[model samples]
Target: MTLSRALAIAGFVVAGLALLAVEWAARRPDSRVPTLGAVVALVMRYDVGGLPVGRLAILLFWFWLGWHFLAR
Candidate 1:
């Protein structure tokens, strides 16, 4: 596969792990993993251009942690 595709996949994986980390961390004081996941999703959806930001957004939702369900 192309490097860009590989990186995009990797980025998605990292972002996913970051989300999970944040969620699990939320069970304690250093609840940075969940927040970090939201941040990653936000950053990925920030219109980076030709970098699979869309893919990141999609993957970020896979966890369904509902990190943004109450904001409306």
Candidate 2:
């Protein structure tokens, strides 16, 4: 296999492992690892000049992701 293809596969493997770790952590009742929802809530709590800058940042990120990956 080409180096690029091998690197891509390795990246995917790492991502999958990370996802599994998060899932495992989230399932434990007393685990210190925060769930994804908690993380989002924490981000959403930030504000600047009474504007929800954190939410705006997350919305912009989603828009950019969709524009690049889901746009036809």
Candidate 3:
């Protein structure tokens, strides 16, 4: 296989492993790893002058990511 294709496959494998790890951690009650909802709540708590800057920033990031990588 070409080097780029191999690298892409490796990247996907790593991402999948990371997702699995997160799922496992979130499922374990005694695990120190914070759940996705907790992380989002923490981020959403940040604000600037009564505006939810963190939430807005996350929304913008998701929009940009979807537009660039997921859109056909």
Candidate 4:
């Protein structure tokens, strides 16, 4: 794959890991870190794809939906 595609995949993997870490942190009471981490993950997922167009559009749509709910 091209460098761009590889980076995109890497971004997705990293975001997934971050989201998991946030969930783990969320289990701890009084921790706001989880919420912050989850938001970062959502933003990265939105940004690494760069824009909402073509295949990215479909992916961004779902990402935005998740962000809308989870980010709140």
Candidate 5:
């Protein structure tokens, strides 16, 4: 696989894991995963008029990366 494809896949995998981590953290607030809890809190607190800026930016980044790699 090309480097771009590899990177895109890695990015997606990491993002998925982060979402799972956030969920886990949310379920058990006393959980020791401070970083994940912080991430969840940041996402929960920040927004662009009702929309989640962080998630939206992530999706857009992934779309742009996929397009850049696959369009050639």
Candidate 6:
């Protein structure tokens, strides 16, 4: 594999681990370390008047990206 492709795969693995850790933290009621997901929850407008389309699409993109890298 090329250097760039290898770097990308490594990055993806790190990101996936970080995201999973954040998600785990966010689920904990007594956790002190804040998660990126929590900050995004405050800032992002995932829904206007309560629709989930925008958030769902973004999630799909992330999933596709992870799959693409791992499939390489």
TM-score of each model, paired residue for residue: 0.40, 0.72, 0.71, 0.43, 0.42, 0.48
Best by lDDT: 2
How many clashes show up per model?
3, 0, 0, 0, 0, 0
**RMSD to true structure for each model, in Å:** 12.3, 2.5, 2.3, 11.8, 6.2, 4.8
Comparing 1 with 5 on TM-score, the higher-scoring candidate is 5
- Better model by TM-score: candidate 2 vs candidate 6: 2
3 versus 4: better lDDT goes to: 3
What C-alpha lDDT do the candidate models reach, one value each? Answer: 0.70, 0.90, 0.89, 0.73, 0.78, 0.78
On TM-score, the candidate that comes out on top is: 2
lDDT string for model 5 (1-72, tens) is: 999989989998999998887777767857665566576567666788888887777678789988987988
After superposing candidate 1 on the true structure, give the runs of residues whose Cα lies further than 4 Å from its correct spot: 29-72
Q: Give one digit per residue, the lDDT tens place, for model 3 in 1-72.
A: 999989988998999899888978888988888887888889989998999998998899899979977999
**Candidate 6 per-residue C-alpha lDDT over 1-72 given as tens digits, one digit per residue, 9 for 90 to 100:** 999989988998999998898779777898887776666565455677787766777788789978975877
Worst 10 residues of 5 by lDDT: 32-41
* Candidates ranked, most accurate by TM-score first: 2, 3, 6, 4, 5, 1
**Candidate 1 local distance difference test against the native:** 0.70
Looking at candidate 6, the ten consecutive residues that score lowest on lDDT are 37-46
lDDT of 1 at 72: 56
> What's the lDDT for residue 52 in model 6?
75
- Whole-structure CA lDDT of model 6: 0.78
